[model samples]
Structures are given as structure tokens and as C-alpha cells.
Target: MTLSRDKAIIGAMEILSELIIIALLSIAGGVIAAMLPFAFPPAVISLFLLLLLLFLGIIKEDGLSSSSSFFLKYMAMFFVPSGVEIIEYADLLSSSWFHIILISAISMLITFFAAAKAVEITERLMQRRKAA
Candidate 1:
């Protein structure tokens, strides 16, 4: 009983630490965004900072592995608030549904085409490297 309790305590502590790290990084991004003159989203800055830290080896993937996995596993839940807000705008959506659907479909097709072209280019470069 004591051993299991200790293990549970340790696991909780690790989860807390992971949350703290993520919060701190987000706060750091907000601070940087505030210091800048122009308007910019703090979340975007935060993501960039996180990527920079990972690339510079300041933060290792393994350290955030568990928390990252947990977040990704339920990421759809994070969008629940936005989905709710869309419900609030049901009138606007209903009136412009056709336009919205058309734009969304066109944008999706463009995005898909761009992604496919990028993959093709990358594969061609990789093949050339292998040949040489």
C-alpha cells in the first residue's frame, strides 16, 4: 500500500511539473508579445518560442513527452469552446452557409494541392541525394 501510494504521489508531481513548464513557456511568450510594438497573438509567439527551444536543445522532447501526448490525445476537446461559440453564431452561419461552404471547400483544395506539391518536391530532392 505504501509503495503504491508513493508511486502515485511521484506521478502526480511529474504531471504538475509538466503543467508548470508549459504554463511558464506560455507566460514567457505573452511577456515577449507585450513588449513588442505591433499587434500579434501571444499564442503564436508562444508556439514559435517552444519550437525554438526544442530546436536549440534547451528543452528536450522526452521531458515533455507525457504532457504533450496527453494534450494531443484530447486536443479536439480544446476546440469545444470555439464550437460552442459557433453555435451562438448560428443565425449568421445559416444565412451565409452557402458562401462559407464554397470558400472552405476551395481553400481546402488549395491547401491539399500545396501539400501534395511540397511532398513531391521533397521526395525528388531525397531521391537525388540518394542517387549522388
Candidate 2:
């Protein structure tokens, strides 16, 4: 059997509305984080809240498809600031390239292992839930 993908035809208003909703949620997340004494990154909290909203069907994927696509398409552009920072630190980075590479590779491996284990655990739990 052949699989077909459904392409969502998104309009400008839909993109705008979705962006507004996301912005409001992010602002709310930031406010909540600020009110707490703990050190929590507002952006991560907002993203987690967004994921929860999507999972709960409070925010439909279609509603944010256009905006998400727009952001994803220009995701590389988001790294410009980081690129500039790296350039500014070129002297330090060049001197410690070996150490940087080693740490990066180690961190990457750790992250990969963590993500794989998480997925495996989640799948096992899902299977158990289904079996029950």
C-alpha cells in the first residue's frame, strides 16, 4: 500500500492567530517561572506547556502548522547569533579545539544514549498499557 501525506493549506490569519496563542502561552510561562524562587528556563517551560497543550488536544496541530513550518524553514537563521559568538571567541576556541571536540562528542554520545533509553522505556510502558 502506498502512503500519502496530507498537505495543510494554511493562510496568513491562521499563522498569525497561532503565533499569538503561542506568544501568550510563552509569556504566561515566563511569568509563572519568574514568580517561583527556583531557576527554570522560561523558554523550556513554555515549550513543555505547548507540548502538553498539543497532547491534550487543547491546541490542535493544524492551528499551528503554518507557524511551525515557517519557523522550521528558517531555523538555520536562528543560529546566526551563536555563529557570531563563536567567531568572537575564535581565539579561545582555536586554542581548545581538541578539548571542545572531545567534550562535544562525549556529550553527543550521552544525549543519544539518554534519548534512546527514554524512547525504549516509553515504548515498553505503552505496550504494557495496551496489553492491560
Candidate 3:
């Protein structure tokens, strides 16, 4: 089904409203983190705020539907901070290139084996269940 112009406008408004509320809540969480002595990463703070909202029933699954996809899709927009900081410390990363490469290779191999084992175990279990 196609969304008519009026329906599209309404949908856009609803999405905007959801986004404004989420953004305000996130900002509030950030403010709380700033007030506390211990540092909480923004990601953790936002997650905690989301959990609280979910538990309090202020926001439910519907509120986090396709509308939330906009924020999620653009989340990489916030990655500039990480990129800048990493670039600033590029020398340190360069110094550990060999170690990083070794760790990556080992991790890749381990992940491949674990995934293969998981698939085999799951298929066997499913087959047994089907037989029963």
C-alpha cells in the first residue's frame, strides 16, 4: 500500500515527535551523568535511560519502531569524535599494528570454528526434535 501525501505528512510528524522525545530523554541522561562524580559513557547512559523508560512504560516497542531507524541509521554521524581521537593517537595504533593483525587473525579463526560448531550442534538438535 502506498502512503498518500496526507498520510505521509502524519507519519513524518509522528516520527519527528518520537525523535524529539528520545533526544530530550538522552540529553537528560547526559545531564545526570555530568552531575555524577563517576563517568558514565554516553552510550551506557542512553541505554540506562532507555531501560528505565521501557520499565516505566513511558516508551514501548511501537515507539521504537521504524521511526527510530532514522536515528540508528545516522548514528555513525556521531562517530566523528571517535575517528578524530583515534587519528590523534594514530602513532600508538601504528606501533601495535603487528599485534593487532595477530589478534585479528586468531579471533577470526576462533570465530569461524565456533560458528561452524554452533551450526552443526543446532542442526543436529533440530533434527532430533523433528524425529521426536
- Per TM-score, the best of the predicted structures is 1
| lDDT tens readout by residue for model 2, 1-132 | 122222233355677799899899889889989998999999888988899999999999988987888888998999899888888888998999999899999999999999999999999999999999
Model 1 over residues 1-132: C-alpha lDDT tens digits? 999999999888888888888999899989999999998999899899889989999888887888999999999999999888998899999999999999999999999999999999999999999999
User: Model 1, residue 128: displacement in angstroms?
Assistant: 6.5
Query: lDDT-based ranking, best first?
Result: 1, 2, 3
Error of 2 at 129 (Å): 14
Candidate 3 lDDT by residue in tens digits, 7-66: 998788888888887788778888888988998876578778888888999888687786
Per the 3 Å backbone cut-off, how many clashing residue pairs does candidate 1 have?
A: 0
TM-score per candidate: 0.80, 0.68, 0.60
What lDDT score belongs to each candidate, Candidate 1 first?
0.93, 0.87, 0.85
In candidate 2 the C-alpha lDDT for residue 64 amounts to: 91
The alpha-carbon lDDT assigned to residue 24 of candidate 3 equals: 84
Off by over 4 Å in 3: 1-3, 71-88, 101-132
Cα deviation at 53, candidate 2, in Å, is 1.8
